[model samples]
Target: MASVQKETIIDADPADVWAVIGDFIDGPTRMAPGFVTNSRLEEPEVRIVTFADGTVAHERLIARDDQTRRIVYSVVGGTMHPTHDNASMQVFPHSEGRSRFVWIRDMQPDDLAIEVGAGMGHGLSVFKQTMESPR
Candidate 1:
């Protein structure tokens, strides 16, 4: 499997970041407003999201741990090469009122690494900006 991991220091409280990320359905659209244009909940653990770049993906929630501030999901169907893809996002206390945000994706077909990595990079950048911006 091809894996990509991206981490960033978010200038916000870990709980605040988790609150945004833990929503599962409305989370992406609200947390990264522009990056994720729309999100529709198909079920309690499934969502369909449309991205800023006009890509659509169907994702299923794998696990969400409130105590650990972590969420795990898998791309069941998508425009991207998805032989198999599983992703996880976790938030940890970094410092006073700051959080360490980590996003990781594991997918098949190594050739798609560049595309997935770039998308993740942009998403993380947007997430940081959105989380740190005045609410």
Candidate 2:
């Protein structure tokens, strides 16, 4: 499996960041508005998201831990044909009122790595700005 990992420091509290990132349904759009055009909950833990490129993806929420400020999910179906796609995001307290956000994705067929890694890089950059900007 190929994996992509990204980390960023946001000038916000961990809980504050988690509050937005943890909301599986609306989080993507709110956390990375330009990248994720739309996100809606299909079921309790399933979500259908529309990307900026107009590609739609169905993801299932695997786990959410408030205490650890972490969330895990899998891409069940999407434009890309990957044998497997699992991703996770976690937030850690960096300093006074600052947070470190980490995003990781594991997929098969190694070729998927470049696309996912690039997406995560852009997503994380936007996420950091969205989180640090005035609320």
Candidate 3:
């Protein structure tokens, strides 16, 4: 089992940050260049992203808690996913009108979990950098 969590403080407003994060398909475009091969709308607004490395992950808008500004998303299923069962989250918070992005990935096991989770944490760091850097 593995678990990874990453948090970043951005100077932009939470809404501005969510504007970028909401584009789930753009995760590859903005989060990691060349990482996402393609993404399709599974339904009205749900998206499934296929990675260049062959990981197919599904994401749906689980819920939007306005009070917390937390955009809940989940991986219903995927191939070569972080684990046989995987779940993640993107927590958005407004601190002094700035956006604080929190990414959390929960997977089972210990050793392998840290490896995968750390990789994810690094990826999320890239995402934060790209999203916040004059884009």
**Which residue ranges in model 3 land beyond 4 Å of their true spot?**
24-28, 44-46, 81-97, 109-112
Tens digits of per-residue lDDT for model 2, 22-130: 9999999989998999999888789999989887889999999999999999999868778999999999999999999999999998998998899889889999999
Q: All candidates' lDDT scores?
A: 0.91, 0.92, 0.64
CA RMSD of each candidate after superposition: 0.9, 0.9, 3.2
Alpha-carbon runs more than 4 Å astray in model 1: none
Query: Model 1, range 14-73, lDDT digits (tens) per residue?
Result: 999999889899999977888899999987789999999999999999999999999999
For model 2, the superposed segments whose C-alpha errors exceed 4 Å read: none
Instruction: Please list all clashing residue pairs in model 2, or write none if there are none.
Output: none
Query: Candidate 3: deviation at residue 45, Å?
Result: 5.8
Sequence-dependent TM-score of model 2:
0.97
Model 3 RMSD vs true structure: 3.2
Per-candidate TM-score against the hidden true structure: 0.96, 0.97, 0.70
Worst 10-residue lDDT window for candidate 2 reads 75-84
